[model samples]
Target: MYTPPAFRDDDKDSLIATIRAARLANLVTATADGPLATPLPLFLDETEGEHGVIHGHLAKANPQWRVPAIGDGLAIFMGPDAYVTPAWYATKQETGKVVPTWNYAAVHAYGPVEFFEDADRLLEVVTRLTNLHEGARAAPWAVSDAPPDFIQSQLRGIVGLRMPVVRLEGKRKMSQNRNAADRAGVASGLAASERPSDREVAALIS
Candidate 1:
């Protein structure tokens, strides 16, 4: 992630928040064959190591887990994003110097990839992940809601992943490069747009 100084977001807590908010993430790993990627719903565990750890599960048929990773796997988390038109910038009317760009927030986490098949650990990971996503529901569900034998059988078809985060990079390109007037113009334009994603970027700018 090549983040300019004005757009960089290195705050540890803020980086973790972005990851948590991005319920789904892309896991990327390189190998002798080629680059492999999987879209996964990963949870961050801040208590684990210096940076933190990530947990998730992949289907047994997914070849990503079987290949030897050449280096630390990267998890990409994306937040609200939108396309910003030059019409949204104050400079567009002044000198027409503004060009279109994208505004968004993202986090990149790097760490050694670890995969395991231990049933107990898998159960724990699944339970915690389930609770995290379901806690807000009126009727929350748990792993125990299913029969033990059925749950055990289901676990056999997937592999558990653990990545102890070694480094993190974050970026929030929310029109911070623009002047106050330009930023305000961008926010107002976005706020008036019908796209929900545009509305989200509007809130960030404001």
Candidate 2:
């Protein structure tokens, strides 16, 4: 990520918060054939290693897991994002020098990738992942709700992945480069937008 100093986020807590807020992430790896990516629901285990460990699963049929990655794999997580119109900038009226840009938050995590098929480990991963997402629901569900045989069969169709994060790059481009007046203009404009995501970004402007 090309993050300017004003937009760079090096706070470990902030980086983890961004990752946890992301409902889905893109897992990318370089291979001899080419680059392959899969959209996955990944979770970070902060207790694991120096940086942290990421856990997720991919369909067994997905060739990305079978291919040997040339180097560390990357997991991309994105937070609220919105397009900022130049019209929202106070500088636009003052000097007409402002151009449109995007405001967003993102994190890129790099680490060695490990794909596994152990049934016990797969079950543990899936169970934890399920609980993580479902715990907030009014009527939460569990893996034990299903028949053991059925769950085992389902697990057989997917492969689990583990990655211990070696590097974490976080960017929060939320009008930090703009002057206070221009940032307020952007926040006001975004807060009025119909898209909920825009309003979410507006809250981060300050």
Candidate 3:
């Protein structure tokens, strides 16, 4: 989150895009006991609130929900990332002054956290989340595919969460601080990497 001016991303669309692209996110909250974090598949309900609302669920056994949060909760979403070797920097060849770095996109959303056990709301949340992830598949599944009693029992085992986003912080460190030549070198190097994630980062270098 310590984004330099050159790497700061204040564009709303860009921030939302990073969040949507992230298949999983980390939810963190400060508590009297300590800090707790859960990796979850969260979705943003863009129609709600000023910034929007985040929706997800946690296992009922997860103590994070039982412990009262002292302040706003944070949800972290990360996009494509790759390690950038100094060898990819033209400055390394020219002046040997460049060091290794990382290129990635990330978003942090902060807001009050609410956990609920309402069966109806839990059912809605699970259904929507399932559709969001399965929409792209050829044989997309649905909550209705399962028996209602079974789904209800499953819902009883988890708690739904909602966080109306009060703030959003985005960072895109894609060689923006580097000179054009160095950036081009980085793009090319990453594009040639066998790692698909590196290639994905290469596409975002501009």
Candidate 4:
């Protein structure tokens, strides 16, 4: 991810938190044809492995699952991000030597990838994913909510994915490189923004 020392985040908990905060992520794998990527809703099992195991599923027709992975796959998780204007830097007024940049948080996990079609395992993955996304809803839905025959038919159309994380890399660029005055300006400016992501980044800065 080319993270500089100042921007690198090595804290395991912080890295996992960023992954959880990202509602969606991209899974990338190298292949003989080229690099293939898929946008997916992946869940992490923090209790497993030194890092954790990632779980998700793909459409049965997805070519990504059919392609043989050359090496470890990379799953990218992105958190809150915001644009930082040069105007948000005190140095812009003091020396006019500032430029625009971005502030954001992200995590990259690498691991061997596995694709499967076992109905029992697929059912478990589907149920867990559904529950995770619906956990906070007043009227939560479940795989069991549907007819067993219907659910079984639906499961036939998809495949499951598992990746036991071998390593994790995280970066949090929240104006920590800036002077105190500039950092304050960035936080305040973002806080005033109407964009929810900007405001989220503002909270991280503070």
TM-score of each: 0.97, 0.99, 0.99, 0.98
Tens digit of per-residue lDDT, candidate 3, span 75-177: 9999999999999888988999988889999999999999999999999999999999999999999999999999999999999999999999999999998
Provide the overall lDDT of each model, using Cα atoms, as 2-decimal numbers: 0.94, 0.97, 0.97, 0.95
Residue-by-residue lDDT tens digits, candidate 1, 78-104: 999999999978888899997899999
lDDT computed for candidate 4: 0.95
Count: clashes, candidate 4: 0
Candidate with the greatest lDDT versus the true structure: 2
Per-residue lDDT of candidate 4, residues 59-137 (tens digit): 9999999999999999999999999999988889999999999999999999999999999999999999999999999
Evaluated at residue 26, the lDDT of candidate 1 is 98
Candidate 3 residues lying further than 4 Å off, grouped into runs, are none
By lDDT, the better pick of 1 and 4 is: 4
> Candidate 4: which stretches are off by over 4 Å?
none
The regions of model 1 sitting more than 4 angstroms off are: none
